[model samples]
Target: MKRSLDGFPKIEVNTQRKEGKALKKEFFRKERDLLGEEAIPENAYWGVHSKRARDNFPFSKKVPPSLVKAYFAVKWACARANLEVGLLEAKIGNAILKACEEGMEGKFNEEVIVPIFQGGAGTSLNMNINEIIANRALEILGYSKGNYQKINPFDHVNLSQSTNDTFMTAVKVATLWQLDELEKEIINLQETLQQKEKEFASVLKVGRTELQDAVPITLGMEFGAFAEAIARDRWRLWKSRERIKEVNLGGTAVGTGLNAHPEYIARAIVHLNEITGLPLAKAMNLFENTQNLDVFSEVSGLLRSLAVNLRKIANDLRLLSMGPRAGISEISLPALQEGSSIMPGKVNPVMCEYIEGIAIDVMGKDQAIAFSCSSGQLELNHLGPFIAAHILEMIEELKLGINAFTEKCLRGIRANQERCNELLEKSFALATCIVPYLGHERTSELVQECLREGKNFRDFLIEQKIFSEEELKNILNPLEISRPGIPGFGKVEVKRP
Candidate 1:
């Protein structure tokens, strides 16, 4: 019954109880380098290094759950490799493997207490994982949780592995897993856009450049471009898999595979691939793979491109759905919530705005990742934890944003046919339909005349006797002008006298 500043009890293991009293939980002393022996809770599935990390780096409550699962997978693969090469005994290896499998299933997650950002190139996180798995494996073997003499975290659980290789490999594996979800979300967004494209296929609207009406285009075609951009993002997400698939799992400390069996080094990645069910391959040049983190930077660039595309689409949506009374009002977005506290019925493009914010965050993370990747020196890049944190954040945010946009906005959009036709009728750029026959100079003269007189282009064409009503109707067909492939619209048989 004790309390700490964080409002949680300073937990102590129960070690003794007098006769007729229930026994208190027991604790054991664990010792390490530079730091002396300390009492670790007997029930807690982590060792002294983990406790040290919890005290040293109080940045966050914990790392991502995906990362924990990925580390479990890595440790299990290492155990398998160690057992195969006869470096670790079968009984201890089997127990460690069981603990790892359970860890992947989300067991022992409470033991992963270290913050993601720490010194030592993720050594603290790696040791924390090693400790958790080792303690849990010892418990499985009917020994105390902190009994390192019988089942040591470093000697048995972390055999044939180093923090540099294992942690980086785990980061890539976890990133790929998260990217799988991101890919699905991107595909969903693209499909929604394509559906909207088909729905608005025949809706004619004026296309603008520099905020000035330049020509005519269908609303469908505009949405089709959005879909195409998302499709490219989807492709980029898939392509990133190849770049990250090359991992350095066996290249311990400095990628020289020192203190690890040659057989263990050769087979460790094979076991990792089997465990993760990912197409992971060991790097041919372990040193380069361990030293250079450019692959993550490349993936970050792809993610940044996705954010840019998302921002463009969201901005267009905001513009298109500006106002019901005075703005473009070309399309109406679904009203999910009241936009203003004072104004009644003022619904905003909140979903698009939310997506825009997420895009900006993703782009920012990409820049941070690029800088972190370049900051690495010599045998290791200590910036991996930072890179992993940002990449995962970007993926999760984009996934959620895309899903919200698809469900709340894209699916519920309704085109204003009247407004679309109204704008097209008002746009003089439609005069370009007859430019081939009338020549640019003649078309320009007519356009200027219509603008100067404040007359609609259609009426001016009819008044000038350039063509009869039927001919003008056929020439200025909105759909034909937007797509511009009709047979006779542009074919001038004779010049107007």
Candidate 2:
């Protein structure tokens, strides 16, 4: 083995490969398992199980980076418990602990390569980590990478754990942290929208029902509604964490705890919670915990609700800021980039479109998670890898989309006050303000008569002396009509002769 100043064999790989050329590696180390023996790269940290998985499931999908980090946290905690319970030898246990601590910090994420969706109910993925840690533990103890004789991947690193319990525990831990990140971003978006609500508090615009003008509304009200919907989503999402708090890590394969020591089982979860600082609990009904994945469905439902609100709000923004000339240009989003190639000076609401795209994609991921959750077998939910992949992807995409929507689009939006006033000027919905002065039946009849005559309702109000010009202007003031109570009810009394 090649030696470095650290006294352990130098761990380095040659990666300069041309299109048709092979990776120029200088040495190889042989390692074997139940399947067979194989020559692994001398300096590479991964071992035979990882190599076999690489060849078998030839997909670009690696375990989600977050899940890798979380998986190693599970390993680290289990190893600690095993050491305390006299299962792991002292020196080797310390080496394994150091390796796992590094893994938890994401030092060896590149080694956790496997298809995000794979067979063996995630055993291949679990072994990949075990192999990496075992090799690294060997290297740490002044031995070569493939010298599993010094510290074995299965017998030492995975001492009291099974793929079923460990993988799902990692998924839950990773999801808890992912939820924390996403919740912070949601809070950012909610606060920003609230600020915009205050900024546009009095900018009046036409309120639409089914895309038809129905009443007067302030632009602030629109933003307020968006903020409120996100607030509800934030609460629901925060509450949804309760569903995944219970983890079944101590229950080995099939929830039987068949190979795990009772002392290891009791203390492992405690160490795990200490390492992760999450509200983790061992499953009371181990079988249910192993086989039931409906918690994913519940959380996905909450995520879908948020996606729906995001889609609706973003689409509304797209429509509200549609055009600077011909469309409903009542507001202007930040002009991010050139919207068209052939057309000159055409700026579209691409940010809103981007957010809408993310929302739609997240909705689809939620559906995929639903199906994956339902694919569980009798003793264990074999689809955790698939479910976890989509959940992590959805969370990352949502965080990115929400952050973009907040800074690039939502914060930079400006209410076109003049355009808002112009829209209400030609409107008939302003006639609703007169309903408090005139009874509903009389106002409805008069509105129908004006529509039939193709005459302006405000002009007719003045011509018929139902109201003076000043009185009509005051009664139909966009700002006044948009506020609570009847516009000009007490102030402008009808001058009836």
The per-model lDDT (C-alpha) reads 0.85, 0.85
Model 2 is weakest, by summed lDDT over 10 consecutive residues, at 3-12
Query: How far is 166's C-alpha from truth in model 2 (Å)?
Result: 0.3
For all predictions, the C-alpha RMSD in Å is 4.9, 3.4
* Residue-level lDDT for 203 in candidate 2: 82
Q: For candidate 1, what is the total of clashing residue pairs?
A: 3
Question: Please, what is the TM-score per model?
Answer: 0.92, 0.92
After superposition, the stretches of candidate 2 with alpha carbons farther than 4 Å from their true spots are 1-25, 448-456, 468-484, 494-497
Candidate 1: lDDT of 263?
89
Tens digit per residue, CA lDDT, model 2, 462-487: 77777788887777565676567777
lDDT digits (tens) for residues 314-405 of candidate 1: 99999998889898989999999988999988988999999999999999999999999999999999988888888888888999999999
